[model samples]
Target: MTETLLVTGASGHLGRAVINDLLDAQKVAPANVIATTRNPENLADLAARGVIVRAADFDDPASLEKAFKGADRVLIVSTGELDLKSDRRLKQHQAAVAAAKATGVSHLLYTSMPNPEPVSPVLFAGDHYGTEQAIKASGIPYTIFRNGWYQENLFLALPHAIASGKWYSSAADGRIAHGARDDMAAAIAASLASGSKESHVYTLTGPQAYTTNEIAALVSEVTGKPLEVIQLPDEALTEGVKAAGLPEDFARIIVSFDANTRSGRIGMVTDAIETLSGRKPRTLKQFLEANKAALLG
Candidate 1:
């Protein structure tokens, strides 16, 4: 009997990419891979492709149990919910762990962030840190992929900055070792399929760290548009994000991310990605060049 590798959040971008990498890079048979989401209908194509499709909602214990049944390995992609105080993500992670334990899953893998210190002040980092603690206590053989910032996040502010001709940020002059999301996903899939039972934490980051000004220059170079980087006070940045129509709470959380970056909290670069994937990560210039058409459009 072939061992099945189950991946949650299969409908999301990272999740879907992971499933593809498992098939393409690792040569894992699609028949032995299980792709799960809250709505099984979303995965109809995957089901037709011979991949097992199941419905699993992090909030629903029974659903998770059903989805995880007979799985030898599992990968829990962190959810995107930003409201940390509500404990929704905690409950979801708890359900995943409980289901894994009950089903006798051999290995559990979790996607997390670089939380060198629990109180690093990144709003979302706390949730990942807490989940890591819980996983350690669960007594399950696991791997924690502490993913760094993604270069793709630049898309969030790119269009406006391109049109306005000014790059605004609260990141000060601090640098970020932003890895590509697809690269991180590939690393996670590789780790899951490798079948290593020892608990490990890998900090996946890009080959180098670059500042906001450097990124702005790279964007300008690729798009042939003039751009100037403007550093703003954290308070002003938060207010600006809110004025631009983002919810005040969500805006504040993003501003906090910049503030954390400014404090030099997330500036560490690593060779972990190359070590795991056996290839150098795509640089910011390479990323900008490859996505220039869509970025300019």
Candidate 2:
């Protein structure tokens, strides 16, 4: 009997990329893979390709158990919700873990963040930290992919900055080790599809660190447009985001990321990506050049 691998959050970008890597790069048989999501219709193409598509909602224990049944390995993609005060995310994660355990899955893999300290200002780190602790206490064989910041996050801020010729941020002069989202996904897929026996925690990061100024310079160089990095007070940054029509809570969380980046909390670079994926990570310049047209327009 072939071992079945179930991947949650299959409709999202990272999840879909992992599925593709499992099939295209790892040569995993599609018949032995299960792609799951809350909405099953989103995975029609996967189902048509002989891959099992199941409906799995973290909020519903029965759904997760059903989705996880007959699975040897499971990858729990972290949910997108960032609200923790209500404890909804915690409940969802707990539900997934409980279902995995009850369904007798052999190996459990989780997508987590590089949460060195629990008190770091990164808003979503706490959720990952809590989930990691839960997985440890569960006594199930597991692997934790502690992913670092994504270089694409800069693109989210680029369009507005390019339009105004100024990149506003609270990351004054500090650098961040931002890895590509696809690299992180590929690492997770490779580990899951590998024959490794022991459980491990892989800290996925980029090979080099770059500051906001350096990133802005890359944008300028790629687009041939002058761009200036403007450092702002954290409170002012939060206020500016709110003034631009973002929710106060969301703006505060984004500004807090700047504070964390500015304090050198996310500045550490590592060779983990190359070590795991056996290929050098895409550099900031490469990323900028590839996405230059989108960044400028």
Question: Candidate 2, TM-score vs. the true structure?
Answer: 0.96
List, residue by residue over 1-297, the lDDT tens digit for candidate 1.
567999999999999999999998998999899999998999898898889999998888999999999899999998877785687876788789899988989888998888646678787676788788888888999998988889898788888888899978989888898889999888888887887879899999888888889888888988999989899998898889999999988998888888888888888898888877777889988888888887776
Q: lDDT score of model 2?
A: 0.86
Residue runs of model 2 more than 4 Å from their true location after superposition: none
TM-score of each predicted structure versus truth: 0.96, 0.96
The global C-alpha lDDT for each of the candidates, from Candidate 1 onward, is 0.87, 0.86
Rate residue 263 of model 1 by lDDT: 85
Query: Model 1: residues >4 Å from true position, as ranges?
Result: none
**How many residue pairs collide in each prediction?**
0, 0
